[model samples]
Target chain A: MLGYIIRRVVAAILVVIISSMFVFAIFFLGPTNAAAVICNQNGRCTQERQALLEHSLGLDQNVVPAYGEFAKGVFVGRTISTGPGAHYDCSAPCLGISYVTKEEVTELLKDKYPATLSVALVGGVVYLFLGCTLGILAAKWRGTTTDKLLVGSSLIVSSIPYYLVALLAWLFLVNEFNLFPKTGYFPITDDPVKWASGLLLPWLVLGVANSPQYARFGRGSMVETMSEDFIRTASAKGLPRNKVLFKHGLRAAIVPIITIFGLDLAALLAGTVFTEKIFDIDGIGKWGLEAIPVDLPVIAATVLVGAVLVVAANLIVDILYSFLDPRVRLA
Target chain B: MTEVLHAREPQPEALPTSDSDPFLVVENLTVQFPTHDGLVQAVSDLTYCVGLGQTLGIVGESGSGKSVSSMAVLGLHDEKRTRMTGSIRIAGKEVVGASDQAMRRIRGKEAAMIFQDPLTALHPFYTIGAQIVEAYRLHNHVNKKTAKQRAVEMLDLVGIPQPDRRVDDYPHQFSGGCGNAR
Candidate 1:
């Protein structure tokens, strides 16, 4: 198990490095010239001003050394300058300063992370709990009217585009009904109630929007598990109805669900762009969206962050399988 | 209707609890499944009885109702899907329309079934001992340790060597025959 974990962690790091390189290459190839953009900031860009901007931004250097510096910045801090007179200190794991705001990109990420994590975590909890319960109930009822109703409703919900569902939720629940406080973000440490109230609609919108897919996944898994001979054996063992259904049936069914769950949570944690943008939460998703076309460093940082999260989620899910199914040896 | 079949005659026997009575009785039992096409008669007017000390072997080709009839006795059929009628009594408890609660009480305690294929019958993720322990725990209100001990004991009874050591091994770890014993 220890060896397996070490190998997976190493592999995950390699994956993140490759993805970061891809992000950097894509930004380099992009049509918008970083040097020109910066020089253009001070009115019309003269040839001398563009050259100076290129040298200051390290754009004049070869791509290899520039990438090397970017990589090194993650381990130790690096200084970034827009011009000879304007130098900025970007702390260790420097993602460079924003083109607009002189603040460190990492600092921006730090500020926004709590909101995204809050939404993702709360939304995750709500969806998993609600989806699993509804799926189990539907599986129990099987071909009955209740099962049909649950499955049909889930299908209908999933058929609609997720963005529309989130938009409608915000429009009605927050705007029209005023059932919730205006959707935005507040630090929980400042005021827990306001923080929750502010995010409540986004959480619900994200949770409900994602739940139908989970419900369908859960139902399919459970329905297959229900017919397994062990379930019959469990029933024949005279276990109470609930025990047979939950302990034996659902326990087995939950392994696949956990796989999807880890990935989904990791994706959301990286950012739910639509959910954050629509709800006006100042999160990494919205920040990443706004940074594109102008800020390559922030975009690259978000890409690397997302890749790390996905790889970490994969590792966690693999470890979970060893517990969920004893037959799966870690090696 | 496809084949001219000889329907077995109903055996007149006493209940199994008493000395002269049979342990189990199934009289004129019919099992059918309704599909998109039509009602498929899986078992028609089956009649049989097993005495307390006797073993009944049901032999037939595939698609035969041998497994189906046994499942009916256990009341293990998909209750909402399959159609079962006539009589199936085990220790004087009628299985045909027994309440789910009653069936739950009777199953595994008063009677247990050894399925033909243990590979599909046993849960693959659980160890043989864990599966046995689960079965024991379901019937007995004992804690995990006691149930585990009983599981080892039961495995030993079934002639499995080193029950203590093998108890933690998963189903695939066992040979085909030993897996069946589990």
Candidate 2:
């Protein structure tokens, strides 16, 4: 057990290391050019100004030294920069400062987390339930009109780009029917009801758009699980149809259903830029777009936030397997 | 479905409490499943009885309808694709074709079951204590605190000693002989 745990933990650490390396490489590749471009843009060109920008962002230093300093801030919890906006620390355990904001990445991320979490969470719930229900219905009504209609509808919906669908939903539902808020966020603490209502519109739209995959997967899983001997045993036991379906069949089919949940959350959150933009929602995806160009601190912070969200979602999926089925252990 | 159950030596205590009080009786059970090819009669005219307190060991090769017969007793399959006609009584209550509300009242409370694989059946995202409490609370009207305590008790009962210290540990911590020793 200890060996297994160590191995798994090591693997997770390696994944994080690799991902962080990728982020570092991408950011480093452009820093020098990026500084030159930004510093010189809309101003009288001067070597002194460009030098100032390079020095401020550490573009003047070698990549290894800058990485070392970044590593120190991340590990030692010590601030490297101590200036006006530069007071934002790049201490240990910290990702770093944004080239634009000169603020600590963590602070910027903290402000945006709720929005990302909200969109992803609501979208996940909506898509999962709708997709599973439709899938089960389609499977149950196979060869019937309902089944055919659903399959056709699912195919059509699945083919449409999510961004396009979000726009259409915005045009039809928000603009015409006024069935939902145009878009924007309402903090739960400020007004829970409004926050809930604000989230409802996106959830419905995202759910409708995202449900096709769920329907397909759910139907497949249900069909497979239904054939399992245990399901038959449950039905034969004279357990009512509901118990047979929910308890036995649903339980058995859950692994596959949940397998997609983490990915779905990540995708929905990432996709929310379009959804939020269409609805005028003030979520992180939209925030990312709005903050870019002028606010580098917010950009890196937002990316870190997204990375954290994705990682957390993955962790959640891993733990869910054991509860869904005892057959699986941490190993 | 675990296929490993038959290998387990039958325990004297696992036997039904008595023949008089048949815990479950499945009679003349037939399940017909419609497929693309045609309808397949999975289980035909199957009959069995499990008395209270007895774990009636079911042994069969794949497709022998052993598990199907059990599912029939529980009514845990979809009705559209599968056709079932049978009489199943649990504690003198008829369940074959029973309503969902009725079955919901019985499962986990009147009759609780454990799956073969611990990892899949259990959600790894949550601590084992949470899921156990959920199973306990689904049938009972207990507060979260009480339910969690009961979960710990069950964990200890299930051979997890020092439940207090071990309860907070995630499933990963106890995967192999961590608490399995208890």
Candidate 3:
């Protein structure tokens, strides 16, 4: 088991490295000029000024060597300059200085990540629990009016696009009706109540928008599990109805649900662009979205972080599969 | 019209005791299921009885209600989906329309079923010991450790080799014959 985990971890690291390189190459070596964008932002970009900015930012070098410098900056601190006498000491693990803000990309990510994590974790839990419970209940009353109602409602909700739902929720709930508190990111340490109230709308919108898919997945998995012979065996063993449904049936049914959940949560953690944008939360998703066509380093950092999260979530799910099903031997 | 099937006659010498009363009696039991297509009469007017210490062999072609009637004996059919009629008395307790609570007391305590296909009948995710422990713990007020010990003992009693080690193995890990023994 230990050997299997070690191998997975090594493979995950390689995947992250390759994906980071891809992110770097795409943005830095693409048609868009990183130095020119920064120069044009400051003032009219003369040829001399663009060349000076490119040389200072190390964009003038060959792609491989420039990428090497960027990768090295992630491990050890590097000196960054916007123009002459504008040198900034970016600490170790620096992603790069943002073209617009001139702030270290790592520092900006650190500031934005908490909001994204908070929204993702709370909303993820709410949806997972609500969705699975609804699905299980539907499965228990399979072929009944109640089951039809639950399944139909989930389908109706999922049919509508997610962004529209979030937008309508924000417009009515916060703006017109004045039902929920105005949405924004607030540090929990400063004021816990404000933090929760500020985030409550986004959390609910996310949960409501995303839960229908999970409900469908859960219902499908549970219906299949209910037909397994072991379920009959459990019933014959005189286990109480609830125990047989949840312990024996759900224990197996939840394995597939968890696999989907891991990936979904990983995506959310990477960034919830629509939720953050609609709700006005200053999360990584909003930051990354805003960085497009402006801040190349910020975009690269977000993509790199997202790639790492997805790979890590996949590894975690595989490990969890072994624990959930004894038949799944890691070796 | 439903046709009655004959039960194989038991040898007099094979009787454990000369008691005349049958332990299980089913009279005019019918099992039907309502589906999208139509009503499925899985079993109709099934009458049979088996005495204590006597073996009853039910033989028929596929889809001949053999398994359906047996499942009916334990009231295993879904209450909402299935329609059952007549009387099924196990050890003198009527099971045809018994409440779930009453059936729960009888099942796994007074009577238990060994399914035909052991491979799928045993849960794939749980170890053999855990499945046995679940069945044992349902009726008995024993802790998990004690129930697990009994499971190992039961495995050994069934002539399974390395009962202690193999008890922790999943159903798929066991061979066909071993799974059947479990």
Candidate 4:
């Protein structure tokens, strides 16, 4: 088991490295000029000024060496010179200075990440519990009217675009009706009450919007599990209907749900662009979205972060699978 | 050679004696399922009886209502989907059209079923010990530790070696025969 985990961790690291290299290669070697972007932002880009910016940003070097420098910067601290006499001491794991913001990319990510984490974690829990409960209830009722109603409602909810739902929720609940408190992110440490209340609306919207799929997934898995021979054995053993459904049935049913959940939560943590934007929360998603076509460094950093999260999530799901299903051996 | 020949020869069917009393009786039992296409008669007019300490072996091709009939005896069929008629009495208790609560009391206590495929019949997530303990504790008034001990004894009784340690192993860890014993 320890060997299996070590192998998985190594594979995850390799995936992250390859993805980061891909992101760097795209931004550095692509048609878009990193130095030119900064130069154009400052003023009219003369040839000399562009050359000077390129040299300072290390863009003048070959792609291989430039990538090497960037990778090295992520480990040891590197001095980023935007121009002559304008050097910024970017600490270790530096993602470089944002061309537009002039702030360290790592600092910007650190500041915005908590808001995303707060939204994702709270919303994730709400959706998982609500979705799985509804699903299990639907499966228990199986062919009844209640089951039909739950399945039909989930289909209807999932049919609509997610962004539209979030937008309408924000527009009415916060803007028009005064139903919910004003939606924004506040640091939990500063004020826990404000944090909860401020994030309540977004959490609800995210939970409600995403839960329909989870409900369907859970329902389908449970239905299949209920038909397994073990379930029949459980029933024959005189276990109550509730025990048959929950204990014997749900344990096996939840494996697939967890797999889906791990990826979804990782994606959410990477940054909920629509949720953050619609709710006016300053998260990594909004920052990355704003960085497009303007701030190259911030975009690269967000991509790298997203790749790391997805790889980590996949590894976690695989490990979790071994626990949930004994038949699945990691080796 | 003469004795072997006599054994190979077909003998006349033996009739039930007056002293034998049947414990389970199924009379004119018909089970149907309504589907999108039409009604499916899974089992029709099935009549059978089994006396105490007697074994009745049911053999038929797949989808021939063999499993369906046995499941009906235990009231394991989905009440909502299945249409059952006639009478099924297990130890003099009527099973056909019986309420779920009545069936619950009878199941595992009065009668229990062993599924055909032992590999799939055992719950995969739980250890053999846990599954056995669960079944034992359901009808028997005993603590988990006692029930577990009983489970170990039962496993040992079934010719399973290392019953104490093997009880903790999951169904997939056991061989096909071991799983059936479990």
Alpha-carbon deviation at A156 in model 4, angstroms:
2.2
Query: What do the candidate models score in CA lDDT, each in turn?
Result: 0.84, 0.68, 0.87, 0.88
For candidate 1, the per-residue lDDT at A299 reads 88
* Candidate 4 wrongly placed segments (more than 4 Å): A34-37, A40-50, B1-21
Considering every candidate listed, which one attains the maximal DockQ?
Answer: 3
What is the C-alpha lDDT profile of model 3 across B93-164, one tens digit per residue?
A: 778667777788888887789997888998888899999998899899999999999999999999999999
Error of 1 at A179 (Å): 1.6
Pairs in steric clash, model 4: none
For every candidate in turn, the CA RMSD to the true structure comes to 4.0, 10.3, 5.0, 8.1
Candidate 3 has which clashing residue pairs, if any? none
Model 3 over residues A120-221: C-alpha lDDT tens digits?
A: 999998899889988988988888999999999999998999999999998999999999999998999999999999999888888887888888889889
Cα interface RMSD of each candidate = 1.5, 7.2, 0.8, 0.8
Candidate ordering by lDDT (highest first): 4, 3, 1, 2
DockQ of each: 0.61, 0.07, 0.68, 0.63
A256-302 per-residue lDDT for model 1 (tens digits)? 99999999999999998999999999999999998887788888888
Every model's TM-score on chain B = 0.86, 0.77, 0.85, 0.86
- The digit string of per-residue lDDT tens for model 2 on A27-84 reads 6665336567667676886888777766776666876787676656667765645332
Where does candidate 1 stray beyond 4 Å? A41-45, B1-20, B141-143
**Predicted candidate 4 versus true structure: per-residue lDDT over A1-331, tens digit per residue:** 8899999899999989998889888877778887787788768999999899789777889989877877878999788887777888888998888887789999999999999999999999899988998898898888889999999999999899999999999999899999999999999999999999999999998988888888888999999999999999999988889889999999999999999999999999999999999999999999999887656789889999999999999989998899889889988
Estimate TM-scores for all models. Answer: 0.92, 0.64, 0.92, 0.92
